[model samples]
Target: MVDVVACGELLIDFTPVQQKEKPGSIAFEQNPGGAPANVLAALSRFGKRTSFIGAVGNDVFGRFLQQTLIRLNIGTKGLVLTEEAHTTLAFVHLDETGDRSFHFYRNPGADIMLREQDVNEALIAQAAIFHFGTLSLTHEPARSATWRAVEYAKQHQRLLSFDPNIRASLWEDLEEAKALALKGMAKADIVKLSEEELAFLVGSEDVVEATAWMLGQYDLQAVFVTLGEKGCFYRTRNNFGTVGGFQVTAIDTTGAGDAFVGALLYQLLEVGESMLDIPQATLEDMVRFANAAGALTTTRSGAIPAMPTLSEVKSFMEAAR
Candidate 1:
């Protein structure tokens, strides 16, 4: 039985690394990445039974990605290797603040080639939570596949978790992106958004006002807005509060948000589908642990490679206190 099943892109991230011998030159370090995959990696580290539903090319990079998930103990039975398109590759550029920008080589990537026929309904039916992002919705076939899986999960009474994970560069039109993002939110029982994403979706800089707008417009059980170093704000149907973040010297903020969402979902598993009934204090504590997980992730370099184990997160949280 899977605790969480994620459906979306799986690809390689080429993170920039400065060359020691050649001061002016930069080298790329290959790491397995993709928002949904990173989230599953975090959950696998927490001892959850997680599965991935996506596609990769039948190439070396694809093979590496497949092995990486297998090594992490994240189920790959739903993963597809196709020759329709090459595996997607992203080059990550980090600013001084460790915030990242992406340059993708996915004009016809294998991830977008995932067809509705590729979706595994059995996998979606067995999972307690079905998590997805808008990346797959940026293109065809995969978009239909994602919707099929989402509707199936909904019909099966599974908790739906949505993270917009917006990449402005990936979308051809900003309005279309916003529309599809809102469509995904309407189906989600829980949502995780970055501060910028909140502003982009709602057109408001005020977190309180924007979140209130979300709760009013959507039939959501809970919503989370991550504030980077400052921490996160959470709003459930019954209660709402803020959770302070852990202070860490971040080297790469690549998968911090994914790790945070993964950790939060891990805690949500204990409550089953009763997310709306969680006490404010308990929800705050969960967010605190998730913040620690995210902070620990940024202290390192890669996404999946940087995910902290359950013991590591617990120890870090204890030390912080």
Candidate 2:
């Protein structure tokens, strides 16, 4: 059985890099990206069997992304290549603090073209967890496809993992985006959100209050709010706590949150439905390991390339202690 199955956008990220030949000029480095894909990459690094269900263009970038997944040992049986549109591209701009923003080149990218027919029900049924993000909900056929897969996974009793991973600029209406994200959250068994996303969704700055509201609002097993280098706040129905982060001199924050989600899911999958009953200490340790994974991803540059191996995360955590 597949350990995890993710359905959503798979695209290229053009991360800014310093041009060595010309010191003042900057260059863009192509990296395999997309929140769902990055999460699978992180899981793959930890020796989990993962599969992707999404669409890409029948172009160079699409081919590259497919190969990247294969190289990462993630299954591609559900990945589709289409001629209708080119692959999606995002130019990443990093500030002095390694925090980043994106400018997208996807008016109708291939990812958005994913049809309900492209969704692999068999793949979803074979997985222990079904993971997705809201990016695919921004457009048509992909939106329907995502919901179809979600329903199928739910019917099969698979754990549903969600990350809103909202890019407000991609939406025509922020409120619409918010609604869809909340809709997805309501369906998820596990959810991960950035600090900004938590505030945006809950309309509260207090993590404790917001998480309480979320647990009360949704039929969720657990909710994680990632706070960059400060680590994460997590809450389940019965327990809640903060996990302190590892201090890392981050060069790029890309994929860090996905790494945290991946690591947390890896641990959660070990216990399955019992995750809801795990002790607060067990939950904190899981988040601590996930925080280490996220911090380690930032020490490098790209998304998939930067994800640490299982051994690397273990060694980093050991050394930090």
Question: Best candidate per lDDT, number?
Answer: 1
Q: How does model 2 fare in lDDT?
A: 0.93
In model 1, state the lDDT of residue 40. 99
Give the per-residue lDDT of model 1 (tens digit) for 1-321: 999999999999999998999998999999999999999999999999999999999999999999999999999989999999999999999999888999999998999999999999999999999999999999999999999999999999999999999999999999999999999999999999999999999999888889989999999999999999999998888877788898988889999999999999999986564887778788888899999999999999989999999999999999999
What's the number of clashes in each of the models?
0, 0
Per-residue lDDT over 39-156 for candidate 2, one digit per residue giving the tens place of the 0 to 100 score? 9999999999999999999999999999999999999999999999999999999999898999999999999999999998999988999999999999899999999999999999
- In model 2, the worst 10-residue window by lDDT is 268-277
Task: Return the clash pairs for model 2, or none.
Answer: none
